[model samples]
Target: MTTFLQLHLLTAYPPSNPNRDDQGRPKQATVGGAPRLRLSSQSIKRALRVSEPFRQGLAGHMGQRTKLMAKVLLDRLLAGGMDAAQARTKAEEIAKVFGKIEPQDKKRPEAVQGTTLAFISPDERAFALDLADKALAGEALPTDKELARTVLRTADGAVDIAMFGRMLADNPDFNRDAAVQISHAITTHRAQAEDDYFTAVDDLQRREDTGGAHLGEHGFGSGVYYLYACVNCDLLVENLGGDKELAARGLRSLVRAIATATPSGKQNSHAHHPRAGYVRAEIGGAAPRDLTGAFFTPVRGDDLFDASARALERTAADIDRAYGPAADAVETMDVPKGQGTLAAIEDFAASALERQNA
Candidate 1:
């Protein structure tokens, strides 16, 4: 039986556009026939991957998502005294191991990027760069499949790639399945984006100038958001090449990041940095299920955070009653009630790996 770790969080943000839509406004979703602010799973995962906790904890075991592999290789080769023409040719060969090379941009002819962004592990990046150095030294390198086999990896100490997975369209065999699944966070209560209009004064304005320098308006919203995530502990360990110790560390870092990280959308202007007010962590062999149904009818009360927490607890109990217990054990950190601490939750989630071994 596959063991699973599930996390549910309630965080309150005050008038900030953490995630925006194409119109540059806070993203919104209709739930229970009411509009609510939303934070996309993509945005949440990115925030967690880049959070200080993840960076500090995982350090060298992280991957970078970028399209500049070819450009970076080309620059390195040229700096190593390789001819520019030869460098470009060799760089394209190595870069194609990851993805298709993009057409040279007319505006920036020197920039050579991939058609699609590639998620590359640090080890893979170093390997590609080493190949570039070898080419500069006039070494005859392997071609095509041989080159890709040397450069690509199924799992190469990249915690983020192991958790979120990656797809190499050109080399499907090198793809990895995600071990962690995240849901788009949505407000527990009905909320709508409100426009914030303001004018900025010019610092060097003349005394005679009466009008402001610039005028703009953007959308913002305030509410308690409920976020859900599930981690396949078995798959996580497998993705990390069966390194249980690294898997435990990744889980701990992930929990901390999810509790503290906020999407960086207009954060400078709003400064909306709020930690999760409540977090529930569960571990078990039972199939994973989300508690989003708790807020099917938008929660409403004077203390929105408290009310939302109650709704989540009540929903979990009701579900257990209906379907027998879904989790073997559970831990929670409730700021309002002061029930548990984040450290306890982290330990509880990591214990899943140990339980699986038993």
Candidate 2:
């Protein structure tokens, strides 16, 4: 039986633009017939992957997502004393194993980059570099197929790649399906972005200077946001090549990152780093379901966080009443009430791996 782990979080931000739209204003979504500040799943997942907790916990088991694979390989080959022309050609050949190469710019003819970003695991990166060294040493270059087969991996010990998955347009067989699904966080209550206008004074201004050196305006919003995520535990383990221990550790790190990590939009201007006020974790063989419906009507109260928490609980209870229990086990960490600790939540989520193994 396939097991699923679901997490719901309520976090409040104060006067910050953690995510922005094309206009450089805070992203917004219409929910329950009202506008609400929004945070994209892409931004949230990036934040989680780069979070300190994930870095410390996963360490070497992380991957790099970039279009500069060719550039990196070219630099390494050149540094190894290979001819520049030969290095660029070798780098481009190896890079094509991952994705299509971008056309060389006339101004920066030596620079090489992929047309699309490729998520390269550390092991895969090392393999590519090793291949480059072999070629530099006069070894016959392998075909693109051979290079990809030797360099590409489903996960390659990269927990982030295993969790978030990656797609290789040229080599679809090497692509891994995402084991986790994240929802765009939306404010539980109707909220609109407000503009903040300010001026920066010239540090070396003469006494005669009356006006400021620079002026700008940016948008920010404050509200309690409800976020949802579901993990296919079975797929996660499979993606990790059945390394249950690593999967368990990954779950713990993921929980911590989800709870503590905030999107890095305009943090320098508005340091709105707030932890999740409430968290609910569930694991079971039953099909996964998100509790986004809880805020379909949009929560309202003097204490928005408290009200949002209660609404989430109420929604879960209502769902249970309607469809029976959706999870065999559930754990929560309510920061405001001090009812549970993050450590306890982490243990609870990781315990699913044990159950699966048994």
Candidate lDDT scores, in order, read 0.94, 0.92
Clashes of each: 0, 0
Model 2 per-residue lDDT tens digits across residues 100-120? 999889998877899998998
Error of 2 at 355 (Å): 1.6
Q: Which run of 10 residues does model 2 get worst, by summed lDDT?
A: 349-358
> RMSDs, each prediction?
1.3, 1.2
Global fold similarity of model 1 (TM-score): 0.97
Q: What is the model-wide C-alpha lDDT for candidate 2?
A: 0.92
For 198-245, candidate 1 gives per-residue lDDT tens digits of 999999999999998999999999999999999999999998998999
RMSD of 1: 1.3
